[model samples]
Target: MFCSTELAARLEGVDTELIIAGSAAAAARRPGGDGFTIPIAGGVAAFAEEGSPLDKVAGLGFAGVPEPAELDAIEARYAERKTPVQVELAHLADPALAELFTGRGYRLVNFENVLGRTLHDDPATVRPAGIEIRPSDDSEFDLWIDIAAEGFANPDTQGVASHEEFPRDILANAMRDITAAAGVQRFLALRDGETAGCASMRISRGVAQLTGATTRPAHRRHGIQSALLATRLGLAKAAGCDIAVITTQPGSKSQQNAQRSGFDLLYTRAILVKD
Candidate 1:
């Protein structure tokens, strides 16, 4: 399928909006609730904490290129906090945006691919034997967080690109904050009466964002991930979302799973960092 710029605009807009909203949610839940979001450079500059994944800029350059002063102000926000400024610029965004970052000393750090597929009618839900996928209840919040964190800790290295790794504690905290974001839904995959996998979905503006999914090291290759994906798509369609999107490291197992499930390569985002 042809990937159009308009489609990129819509998908990236939703993703970035959620990033901002998720950061705001994390800020409010903290002790002092100290966090901020700034609308700059035709996108958003958000900070949840010193090393938060959310402390970055996104959906940039869709509007006219910002003046150098505007870019300087964005850097100042992070400079005051003594943290690097990171930008996730979509390949389809205004080319000048990339040039501006390079000219300002932002070096390429990483890349992530945004994949998507249209949701129409009902999804063909996959029911793998010995596995059950169901909504995570409030009482199981911590359990879900632990399972997700553990999965990330033992990541699958069967991909072309390398992925960043974080401490297990930090991963747990990030999962908690993101799952608490507005409209976010959690799912737990059970096998043999034990939790085996966890996933999340967030719906906004007719888009269903497959926020994350991971299976425990001991439970890998039990069709847990596939089941989780199919279940979320079905629910997202029921909720009236026309599009479902997922971001993954290029050629990772996650991306391969998404591709097998009908998602197309919508666009790639270049992560540029200024330290």
Candidate 2:
């Protein structure tokens, strides 16, 4: 129900689907460009890759996530050929689905945490503690990637790599390209000329997605994130955007910042991992 149009655009360009398996719109793989509605039962018994053109059944359906047997069937469909597989659906309705794949020999790897808050176009932008906010240029890509890896606490130093393996360079390139195309605006918070923290905002169809809110060790509790968030929301207001969404952990500084910046909770979407 909450799909980003920018995501739809990127998926169209890359010929990929996000695999949203759910009860309301189950067994329907909404095509990238135009969409279609799927009328099926069993609450998304499976989510498979698009094989042909989707039907124009309201164009708002979901991908039928495959079971272990279904995945095996699909894998066997290609045999020796390898394919990238990703699933980003609800963990409640089909909680055991990922495990089924792992039991069938599919390696479970990598994860991402998501948070969101509705956009307020009239919030005040306050840059407390002398924190500076500036628009970043193309040269900041590698730095952004580096900071991201650091923020994520990744030790590999593997720059911009996807969750999957194979052609590391190619995946990194794809990651950069996708992130670049998200129309994300980056702002770096500086403390006496050093990078204190950074935040990225992606605006699409009157919805603003806030991500990559990170602060350096020495810059914690200095109101750096507060300034950055206020500034970004102010920019969104000036640009006529209506909603801002951000995701953060419970009791985290990022959560506090969002609340302090006048962001109210809309909903929470969780990512369930296999132990």
Top lDDT prediction, candidate number: 1
Report lDDT (CA) for all predictions: 0.85, 0.47
Question: TM-scores across all candidates?
Answer: 0.94, 0.57
Once superposed on the true structure, which residue ranges of model 1 sit more than 4 Å away at CA?
Answer: 31-34, 161-163
Relative to the true structure, candidate 2 reaches a TM of 0.57
Candidate 2 structure quality by residue, lDDT tens digits, 1-275: 24363433322212122112121132222234222222221221122223211111111112344444544544443332233333333232234554654565544343323334444437775867667877666688667555544554532232222243223333234334334444557777787777767777766566566745767766667787787788887787777776666755544556666777766543322322221
Each model's number of backbone clashes? 0, 21
Q: List where candidate 2 sits over 4 angstroms from the true fold.
A: 1-86, 90-121, 154-175, 273-275
Report how far residue 91 has shifted in candidate 1, in Å: 0.2
lDDT of 1 by residue, 156-189 (tens): 9887554356666656556667767766789999
